[model samples]
Target: MIRDYSQRLVVQEVAPRDGLQIEQKWVETDDKIALIDNLSACGFTRIEAGSFVSPKAIPALRDGDEVFHRIGRRPGVIYVALIPNVKGAERALAAHADELNLVMSASETHNRANMRMSCEQSLAGFGDIVRLVAGSGASLNATVATAFGCPFEGRIDEDRVASIVDTYREMGMQGITLADTTGMANPRQVARIVERVLGRIPAEALTLHFHNTRGLGLANVLAAYEAGARRFDASLGGLGGCPFAPGASGNICTEDLVAMCEELSIPTGIDLLKLIELSRTLPALVGHDVPGQVAKAGRNCDLHPVPAYVRTI
Candidate 1:
């Protein structure tokens, strides 16, 4: 299917929260704040600043409160905080998150494994969370993880994903995200599922989160885009994974996605040079190399000078 390719895409940066959450090394609160502040100035209108989960679960992001409080907020940028339940929601609200992102896996086994609760219990808790955040002026976004496939359960039913979207919509969520939690999605499957989801929610309200585990992340993004998805979640330098979901790896890279968008002439309003520079800092912060490509490959416009021998030849 031919995609418009000219449409503007919303790239939601999730590095600080999703990227750092799984890192073994602890990122200092000051560095987190500085990174976020730099991201705020990079033309990102929405960024997942941090999460309010228990520190025992994700020690790397234990300083969510301080990171959120210390970061410089730009006028048009929206700072999002990931929350698991009502307690986390309350803490995120107190930290002044512009949006609250709630997550639940579509597969029952995955949900149990990740949250230690059944799918029904997670939805029930989200209902309470929705009520608690009402009138707080913060927008609510629900992410259905393992929407494409699950490690334990294998292929997830499309109807099950639709049902989860229905539940979130009933709970009054403003946005919904379909996450390929383990990078098991193919382009054909992504297009079909995205079409199914677009039937229930508008294109603007749906976000696609993909991982590059099997090297299909960008292909799935293109498929979803053709199927009417405009928003996407990507981590800087491809630094993210599910600590609960076994075999999960880093998320789709922000710099790589931006590079794809730039190549396609799709407007994302993000500076590729600045994003590449920011991605270069991850190795120092996490004490390891990152997985993104644009940082290493450079853009197509980055021309190299010819060798003198070659020029003479």
Candidate 2:
């Protein structure tokens, strides 16, 4: 089968929430708002602005409400808030989040470790959240963490992932994300599962989230894209990981993904230069250098003048 590679891709920025959640240093609420404001102008249609979980659970995003309220909302940008349960969903709704993202692990062990609940219990809680957010003018996005593989369980079944997507669809969630929580997904596996999931859900309604723990993040992304997935989630400077998931590391970098898309002539509708500049600010925010590579390696078009000795030679 001939694969079409000319589709425009949606890059959803998850820096504010996912990127900073595990940072030990505190990023001021004002700085978070500033970052969002800057990103709002960079042509992203969706940005995961913050999470509404308890401060004790995720102290880095404790000021989520303030950040959401103060940031300038671009007209076309959908500001999203990650919610853990019904209470977080309520807070996200009250804070005027454009979209509420609910998460659960595909693996039972991972779910218990991450959410302290069984997969069934988490889905039951989501039932109440779906009812509460119904007709509230806010869209819901369901994320299946450890969808590709689990650190504790090693390999996950594709049938289990499909069943979870079915449950989310039955609950009236049109937006769904398959998260490579521990970065254990490879290109072939990603393509297979993505193709399988696309059989049950529309490609437009699905998003792929990948981590670079095993150095296959971008490869997995390419595989999914070939399998008809167009939307993806990436963090600035490759900053992200689950506190509860062992071996989980940084997400695929935003600028790196944009660079790859640019090289392949895939339209991402994002300003690569602006995204790079934004990524450069992460080192100071976290009090150390970030894991992203684009900031250090200039674009392919960047050229340096030849040295006098080299010219003579």
Candidate 3:
């Protein structure tokens, strides 16, 4: 397939929220703020800075309010906060979040497991959030989790996903994200689903969220991009996983994604070198090694010196 090298892709950095949420070690509020600020300086137009969920449910990001209020806001960057219900929406709005992301799994089984509620119940709650955020200048985005395939349900029907997308649009969502919650998506599946979603909404309004669980995250990304997806959600150092979904892994690594885009000549407007520098600091911050490859192996442009033995030979 012929690729467009001139295409510009929009990448939303989700490390501060998705990456830190599942961490056993609590990422300090100050550190989270600093991380967001640093990411803002890295030319990202959108960053999922934090989530305004229950402290008991996600204690790692319990400081969401403080993180949103204290972070240094950049002029063009939109700081996003994930909202689970009207209460979370209220908290996010009170903290002056630029965008509120609402999520619901497409699979009935997964939704019940992840949210402890049915899909209809989640939608009802979203309606309340929409009313609450109306006239508040904050945009709303609906995410369909497990859109590709579910861990418990196996293959998901495409018609079911389309119906969900239709509902999100009817509910006045400005943006929508199709999440591969457990990385069960393949390239063909990604292309097919992305094409169908784009038929319902413009590519600008759609974001593809993938996990690296089966090592197909980047492959699915390329397929989606080729099928007309322009926006993506990636976590730094490949940090993050679904606390509710079994066998889920980190997101497609921010540095690795940007590196691939750079090599393909696709414009992401993100500084790969800057992302690499930030990724290098993640292991110490999170208390473990990360899954990102570019940070460890360096970019393709990063060359090494010749060995003396090679010169002698």
Predicted structure with the largest TM-score when compared to the true one: 3
| Candidate 3 collision pairs | none
- What is the TM-score of each predicted model, taking all chains together? 0.97, 0.97, 0.98
Q: Which prediction has more favorable TM-score, 2 or 3?
A: 3
Task: Note the residue pairs that clash in candidate 2.
Answer: none
What is the C-alpha local distance difference test score of each model? 0.91, 0.91, 0.92
List the lowest-lDDT window of 10 residues for candidate 3: 241-250
List candidate 3 segments past 4 Å from native: 242-248
Candidate 2 lDDT by residue in tens digits, 182-269? 8889999999999999999999899999998878889988999998999999998898865544454579988899999998889999
Order the candidates by lDDT, highest first — what do you get? 3, 2, 1
Give the poorly placed runs of model 2, Cα more than 4 Å off: 1-3, 242-249
For each of the candidates, the C-alpha root-mean-square deviation to the true structure, in angstroms, is 1.5, 1.5, 1.3
Q: Taking the tens digit of each residue's C-alpha lDDT, what string does model 3 give over 64-176?
A: 99999999989999999998999999999999999999999999999999999999899999999989999999999999999999989999999999999999999999999
Candidate 1 displacement at residue 200 in angstroms: 1.0
> After aligning candidate 1 to the native by TM-score, how far in Å is the CA of 162 from where it should be?
0.9
Q: After superposition, how far is residue 132 of candidate 1 from its true place, in Å?
A: 0.5
Candidate No. with top lDDT: 3
Off by over 4 Å in 1: 242-249
